[model samples]
Target chain A: MTEPALGGGGLVDRHVAFVAALRGAGLPVSMAESLDATQAMAAVDLRSREQLRAAYAAAVVKRAAHRATFDRLFDLWWPPAIGDGEPIHDEGSPDAESLEEVEPADLDAIRKMLRDALRDVLLTGDDEALRRLARQAVSGLGRADNQPGRQSWFTYRVLRALSPETLMASLLEAVLAGEERGGLAEKVARQMLTERIRQFEEAVEAEVRRRLAEDRGVEAISKTAVKPLIEQVDFLRASRDEIAELRRKVYPLARRLATRLTAKRRLGRSGRLDVRRTVRASLSSGGVPLTTIHKPHKPHKPELVVLCDVSGSVAAFAHFTVLLAFALREQFAKVRVFAFVDTCDEVTSFFDHGDDVVDALARMSREADVVWFDGHSDYGHSFEVFNQKWSDAVTPKTSLLILGDARNNYRAQSVPALRSIARHARHAFWLNPEPKQYWGSGDSAATAYGDVIPMIECRNAGQLQEFVEAILPI
Target chain B: MPLFTSPDDVRTRLAATGYLADDAIATTVFLADALGKPLLVEGPAGTGKTELAKAVATAADAGLVRLQCYEGLDEARALYEWNYRKQLLRIQAAGDGQKWEETHDDIFSEEFLLPRPLLTAIRQSEPTVLLVDETDKADVEVEGLLLEVLSDFQVTVPELGTIVAIRKPFVVLTSNATRELSEALKRRCLFLHVDYPDAEREKAIVLSRVPEVPAALAEQLVRTVRTLRALELKKAPSIAESIDWARTLVALGLDTLDETVVAQTLGVVLKHASDHTRAAKELGLN
Candidate 1:
């Protein structure tokens, strides 16, 4: 029942600072949750870092999406120090000289030694040796002289130099030696080898980050090393790896959005008369309707008409928008997806009932009548074409969503064409994948469009989700 | 007030029931028990979310009341509901002389009250573990009901009155992250994310669950299951499935996990045809 005073009164300050760091990383840590975290930290053995780590994670994190960020921030704030004091290596400590003497300068020799040590760790499951090897790999191969803001780069160097991925086959072969061609065994061994390699890489990365935190202070190291959650990464600027991660998140995002929309729909209930049920129930109340129960309202799913600018720069944004709308097609009464470049075309037919999404996107790009005169993004001309072809597209029941950067190539922005569609639609919103500050710059027809339709700067999946929720009618 | 003496006690008790608790789990469980807050466990499917609730019930030697949530799960199913059919029959049986208030009072009495999982858990004076399984699968409105029940450990029927818990039950909610739970509900609970256990822990689990399986065979089976989990399969082999695989190996008296043995018994682990094909291709099995 007694709260553990973590190292004599430092736990309070440490916990507060750690929480502030988590909040800074975009994980919402409310005041009540912070108190819960403090209590959780008090409940555990304060000396055990893992116990405290679990405590903070269980208390502060409300969902699974924030766990990775929580972990990274936890590491930065509550670092694993060697002793009572933080492991500060200033004034030419023997750590440098001893590391140099123990580790070889030759990359090839260090690699060989790493391969052998890693093999031993994997085979024997020696966690102690693995941690030592991670440190060794960083000191020998990564080898940076306390450079500011270079921990990730150093970690990358260590992983590349060690190349544990290449050591997978050899390690597996070594572990399962003389055990014949066991197809499943070899396969499991290979994956196990891969798993160990990943662990080593993670350890080295964590080690480098820890050292940098010890040297440069947690604040400085944290800002540079901790990656923003993948959902927070900007769509226009996300790397291929980040994009792949974002792709994996698409279905879950769609499901959550659907759940919320369903909830929202349920809240906006207006029951209609079901005379059969009402009259049938009235017989029990002596021919008098006491409750007057109306029919359960059939959800009035809205119609959606999406015009996506699938051109050069905004293609990734459009791709995501289209895929999201595709996943949420059931929520809408009808969804007519139109893709455009210099010209416009309704690609709704491209997304057939059972077709693969990636193939459909590819076929839509290849076959759709999106290009009339040139390959340049002529949003003005595209808008006119859409206005001409799909005159009946935007009914009063429809919510119109336009996805683009609004870069009209200095061409005539046919504002009236979009204005006509917006006037007919129940709701209209334009999602610009650029920052709002850059909206009215250069050939952007953002302001012109903004006069007609509400333009939202949706830079990432997170922002996209927020914008979608807003557009869904109550 | 403590269900467990310490974090070590949590580990020991949970381990005695064939459920291993790492320091993190032990600490979180201990804190949840000490603070008298509901514990919310989130994870991928088959990582033992449901089993954790069961194991904690065993550890605490309490009665387990489980609410398996799904879409359209309403208050009538989750909480208390009046026996409407019985109420209707009672209303019909009450002839013209019966007063409205009298019939209403009789129908709303304890004899006519249908107590669901939530109401049952709250009404328990004995030690109890209330499990809301797959909490994310339930509709959002259900969460508002849960928030009220969990925060105060009480339920109200308008006809009768609010009934508070004599002894506060240990509450555990598990979710597969199908949808994000409301913040109001999450705020009342301590969160725990249980991921797939590492190879060593999984091997130990397999050994404990199916002791007839050899140590060497258990190791191989765990490694293989881990590999399948690492693959981009439709449904990865879960801890429970891994235990089943171990039992299958034991029953077959297969000690060595070799090419022929695995080829014959691959069905024991992977269920999906596509997963089988993909595993064969990825693992380079002829």
Candidate 2:
């Protein structure tokens, strides 16, 4: 495809350049967004500030988390006009601030001022002074204005001016480089960065604590057990020990359940005498009939293979279900575990005997992109990956347990993969973490998969355990 | 880096990023700090509650330790679990009665205590921000466990006794309010309910977050998301959703929040096929 000409009845190439620069300078701009920004620029006149503002807004950002970063990048991308960009008002300004104020720079003073300024702006909605202060603070970095590489220098200065983390990182790098100047520069820088980082962290922690403190309505998990006389289902809180005991008790029951479920036997008419069956058969046998005893049949436990999604939205549920599957490996002759976000990995090797399930999960999470967004959920790619690498593991005696939110993000659903796996497996069970009512909405392909096999709603541990009890056997 | 003089200064920051909320954001920020507790923000599905946690993390320059809570979360799952290998080795090496105290202590030691999100937050010496996310979906017992931890910053094990947090861990808990948390836990900390911001606030939020986003387009995007949120969607668009949606549109080279662009990028905000179908039908994208 031919490239669209710059400034030819479209957004100027400079605008795209500005976006690229913004992204390279640490702004999180996607390619799709760059295109949006370009188109937006074309729709609005650059000279008109209002129009320019509207176009930019339309092209980028959707959430509150990105506001400050976007604002900083925006200023850097489109520096204020000369008329609007009055020189820094502080004594620290490039042209006016004394070398003393700029030279023996108090990192703490700068940080405190920045924090107070930020909090003030957030509280009052006026940032003229803060902006001026930011500009002035940049001068203290000793960046020469009007140089060819001045943009990066300016960007760094601004980044340092705004973010205490950036400032601390830069200060540490400077100290490591052995910049011994201004007598106590090194000490001051270290102290300032440390204090600022601390304060910044406290600010964050405080916010979290506030949320945890709030009146979040809670509910009890219902139980099916009851006191002696009558059986009843009631809501109650189960202690950790209670849950553990349940796990221990249920495992044996699961084996018994397996035996009952597959309790079918055939006996031969000749062999060692069968006390019950042979005697009963002899009653129906001919006058001089001899009966043969046959070997009793026992149900073989089905092997299990679980494919779980650990993407940004579904990792929490996946963690629980995956751990449960790992714990129950003893019941089945062979059990395999796999985790996926946009792709799949068989992480069963991590869970050997005596392994801490939590540690194994944590290790896997650290190495894996549990929260990384692959732009889209490509079900096709995940299935293809599994088919190419792990399909052989599944057999006619194996049960496949698939768990996720199943929002495919409009990518290829790869229905054929599920079908193929289902065909080979003894039984296929799709467990959805979300409320059943939310099924069939948005980009979810659950219903599509539901067409192939029974998809059950498994929301809590009780339900999960019951499902396992019902299906984990032959 | 950008500078804001006050919380009000965040208005422009929010506007620049196409965010819509302007009302009581400072109140939310203040309660979080003044209470010396993490803020448990409850909101609708598509509002910016999660983004708020992320924003606070960014603004404060703290390490964001997030624990995405869900069903079947247990003590070992949420707080800590023993590292069996390490425990076994210690047990094997000791193999004697005189080392009883040492062996007992070894199991309860921080080394053996596999720090989940809960323990990790409490153990962090540095200024740490912990996000116990989506508390609604977690079982009531899990919430109770969270309450116990949040109230005292300690975990009690019969073998180890109670391990208290040496450093005060900043906690931020968010919920879609899918289910309510118990009153016992709520009474111990501060509460903030975040809702979708108004048009003006959203405009400001968007501008602040995505400065390169064209002003017209940003405003239009904010308006579009706001409109979508108002609609009867199975999954409403949150601030995070809007941000992703806008970013996706931008990446696709769309200048305006038109129906075509919305259709292509709908997956970001709406996860269900039916939700998309319903939204498209209602919004006239079809």
Candidate 3:
């Protein structure tokens, strides 16, 4: 029942460190919030760790996404001391007795045992036997040392012990050895076995990580341990693998953005009753006000015109920008997408065919005549094409979004064409994938365009998300 | 000046009004009351964000001033607005006797001012709970108005002077986190997130709320709900839905939550057609 060493001064110091840890985990905790939390701690009893943790969380954490990290840091600082007295087992450590019990020979025996068990399950389609074998594989091969980076090692060992390749090979042999009529059934059984084995492998991996999280803390688990890597990936310099990963995350990001925009739009519709209008209308019936009219606050969903530079220099940046625009197309009243390098062409039909963005981008690259397949980017020529043919598309209700590096290859700046488009559109914003210091260097004409349209630096997903949230009508 | 002296006091008082607050909830509520700052509660829908406000109001024996925030929630609707009709009538009744300047000041007086929930809560002599539900649904511009009111506990009317609170009301703003709130507004408040309760807590909730239901049935119902939540359904069942499911079981005179009974009453828990099909299939009800 005694207090754990923390007097009045130490309590404030502990709270300060907890706040620092939350900020380290990427939650923005300002000095004012830290002061508020210290005051909140003073109001609560430090004897109760739960009370102190709640007070600090209530004062410091703002976003729901930061709650998990806050909880982890809180538990680390204020380890519960009461009824939950279970010591850290450290059974997964190399020096532990459990490691000696799981010898290399036992692992080899487990691999063979798993292959035979899976072969029997595949032949008989026994669900119970498959579950039992999955459990055994996890227990036998999922042991780990105290090393922080050994989680994946254990995962790889478990999957290797399951021996999905040998199981598949055996199934193929059985299928080919059977008679022609029975061969078809054996093939179907082999496909089913392949799926079940894949599930079994995943189950073992999940069980190992779950146990490790219990022993070494959830922060030790790799996937959830690291913050999203895509958020920090530079858009302009992203490799093909990084681009693919970013593309996979784009739809979910777009969906979340769209949901917020939709909620704001829906809520804009209903406000207080328009009493003046209702009273005016009720004068015909002796001012009874039979039906009331609420004030209309419907938001105008702006028409979007996306001009993406698909030249070889910024093709990766354009790909992601175009994908995001099309993913969020439903939030706009109308969307027109154009890709340009040396000439401009309306590529809106690429997105209109209801295909996935990746497939649509692939098709646009193959068939769209917007770019002459020239490696050089000429802003003047593309702007001339847009001004000559697509000038009518830039109405006052449209939001013109230009995505490019704004490098002009030292060609004509075409400031007038951009100025005219900005004048015609409701709002014109240029999102440059390049950093700000390089905006006016070399052949980049970003400074000239900035004089015409406000340019925003969007070098990664985080900046791009901020721009979208700011521009989307709320 | 604190409403509750301790966290235990918050728990006991809130429990008297049918709210079973955990240690976290109780502590946060108590600290917010003590600090006299607005409590910003964010969570998934039906996780007792709004219920916390109601319970606090009941426990404090205070009048509840409810303001439902949405897009286009301006100062006129949220804080205060001049009664235009009454003002016009006053102008016509003046009969051209007074000067225009004199009459202008008269029409913008206290009698012509209509107080909204924000103003009403501040002007009250007695303690009150101001519930601003779904604050994130309101426009970003409305956050400006909230910041003005929450920071100084006052409203500025250009026609008149600023109206400060005679007695500061306890404020609770709930959001589903549809959008990120401005940092300036968030800094002026205390934050709480009410997630889905764990199985043991949820079971205790069912037992307390639906007391007529047997202990065994309540445990079974909570287990089924936990399993249903683990499935990737369109919408997960909330704490309110769990309570409703428990009530439905008790009302049907069923003492046991067997597979068939749960299958028949799944509608009370799963609202969507897709969720029903998925839960039934996953539970092997088919």
Candidate 4:
């Protein structure tokens, strides 16, 4: 809409691919945004990759939470292979690349030489040198295995080899070489030095991932390396960033799911007749019963009871499901969120303080009494605890949602306890984050639990979306 | 003429207004100008989302019309509303038995229409910057109203047909991400996320805004603010707050930011009592 494209077909192709990657990562980049991205790229200085990065980010990234994912994917796609056109390809073996840096030195000799060079670069704050050192460091130390088709690359080994912490002593000595032991300059220098070191650590991580991505293709590496699009990411395996992203999308997801539920429970409500309008119409009809006028009807909403297993691997899943349910609380008459480990406790009070879900979740873990006897999940004990504590929470008007994997930790199964609770509620369903095939595995009572309530696989947000439609209406 | 010719042009112009635009900001601003589209700027509070709009308005030497959104904001407050009292008085005075249809048309004319910020921006012949500030705070219904006016650069008054823009004002909408704005609204604009500047850019901002402060002191202040930001506080000190801190240091004639100075002037950068305590505890000031 702005102007015709200025770049060649190559740039347009790259942009389309990048946009596809972004969309697959769960960013809602629309047609107009993609067009704006193309137009934005045409307007910016293409020679500078940072400028191009900013342009694409401005055009595509809608939320702050998605920016980290965008940046990671952007690096993989458009990589800063700038100035130094392409990375040096190893001739003989992948491990032979670092040997080119020195005369076939041993591990200790390489560390000593690399450390000396790193200290100088870090002291001078040279970014280019740091990146170069990152490549060398990864090639030298980041080899976890030599197996083909397996991504054995790890950032930890490289960081461990560099041991940037050991370099900190010398760094502080140089920055505070002649100055007082502790002064304003020292405080400032320490903070700056700490950040620089962290950046170096990130550089090593990025280098390792990039090399892995280059070797095994971006799509394959992205499965293990990059955080998948928020919806496709398993709740059990989601990173902190993905969980935060899920939290941000919870409301919009709720709105979409609510629209779906509205279509299913489209009950026409007949409101109270307006007496003034009805009587005025009756006077025209010789004081007899005639036309009617009704006030706007208030539709009866459902109440929600979320019994979440806030323990072990299922914590993220339970938290997100509870958050999604509570986001739709306006559509519900009441929302009561319960948390359980070995026992049960009502954690609904944690969510009462406005929409600060992060703070509420933090407080729920710290303050809520969800643990009793060894913190191991006991499904039977928790059900009995819930029955004893809040049996009245599940009424005929309520929709009961049990969020757990039903692993049961090889403990006793309380099918009767869950069955009684399910019978009380208008609609009851169990959301197991584990896959369907893993239901009857060792230590997992999911198959047994499925007998009492319909256990559905909700491993990811996409599956949860379907389960949400199933459990919303009576 | 376009507001900006290129991304560099945006940087140069915005810098002159004492607002530094990084590559992303410069590129996004220029695109927003060249495309004649609204710019949706979202970020954490105090990252200078609002300041970007003001800087553009300053750079273009145009009028800045801000529609400060909040709960209970209605069409009468946002778009054009009829002057009901003036219309009623006109009806009472014209008791000479004018036709009802003629009176009805007369009451709804442009003469009785009161243009709010949105309409005011549209009707201006001169260049204007329409800032829909903290848009997420407003009810979702208001977005529907914004969609019609923004998409066509026109407003429909039933009394009078559609009123198109004499000159399309540069639109900038800022959000703190309290809620997600609909995709339809996001689609119409260029999206930009403004985050905290790096240490170097922040120092430049401090020196540009407060030229009175020494460069070394400005560096120290930016470093301290960055450290404070790293701490988990309820509200972090924004770029504007850092500038204010610089001005404070200059006023106090401080050459260096030692522990003594920072502890004493902590309140200058931190407002919340709890935040002060947290910062003090974290920095080991106590």
The estimated TM-scores of all candidates read 0.81, 0.37, 0.59, 0.76
Tell me the tens digit of each residue's lDDT in model 3 across B1-286.
6678899999999999988999889999999999999999998788899999999999999999999997668888998888877877888889968899999989999999999999999999898999999998888878888998898899888889888999889999999876778999999999998999866678888898999999978866776776676555556899999999999988899987656787799999888775787667666675
Q: Where does candidate 3 stray beyond 4 Å?
A: A1-9, A81-256, A259-329, A332-474, B96-105
Give the proportion of true interface contacts each model preserves, from 0 to 1: 0.73, 0.00, 0.49, 0.47
Model 4 C-alpha lDDT per residue in residues A202-274, reported as the tens digit of each score: 8888877777766666666554555556788899888886787787678667866765455334334657898
Better of 2 and 3 by DockQ: 3
TM-score of chain A of each: 0.81, 0.41, 0.57, 0.66
Question: Which regions in candidate 2 have their CA more than 4 angstroms from the true location?
Answer: A1-474, B1-23, B95-108, B258-286
DockQ category of candidate 3:
incorrect
| Candidate 4 residue-wise lDDT, B1-286, digit = tens | 5877888988999999999988789888888888788999987777889889999999999999999998658799999888866887889888977988899888888899999999999999999999999998777779998998888999988879888999999999998776668888988888888888988899999999899999988977998998887665556798889988999999999888888899999998888776787677667675
Assign candidate 1 its CAPRI class: medium
lDDT of 1 by residue, B1-286 (tens): 5678888898999999989877778888888898899999998778888888899999989999999998879998999887777888899999999899988778889999899999999989889999999998888889999998989988888888899998889999999887888899999999998888888888888888888888888887888788877765545788878887788778888788766676677788888765677677677665
For A8-102, candidate 3 gives per-residue lDDT tens digits of 24655656766766776788999999999889988999767789889989999987767766765665456442111222432243323323455
B-chain TM-scores per prediction: 0.94, 0.80, 0.97, 0.96
Highest DockQ against the true fold, candidate: 1
Can you write out model 1's per-residue Cα lDDT over A133-252, one digit (the tens) per residue? 787667677766455755332788887776777766667778888775556667787777777777777788887877666655677777776787777888889887676567556667
Candidate 2's fnat?
0.00
Worst 10 residues of 1 chain B by lDDT: B227-236
Candidate 2 docking: what grade?
incorrect
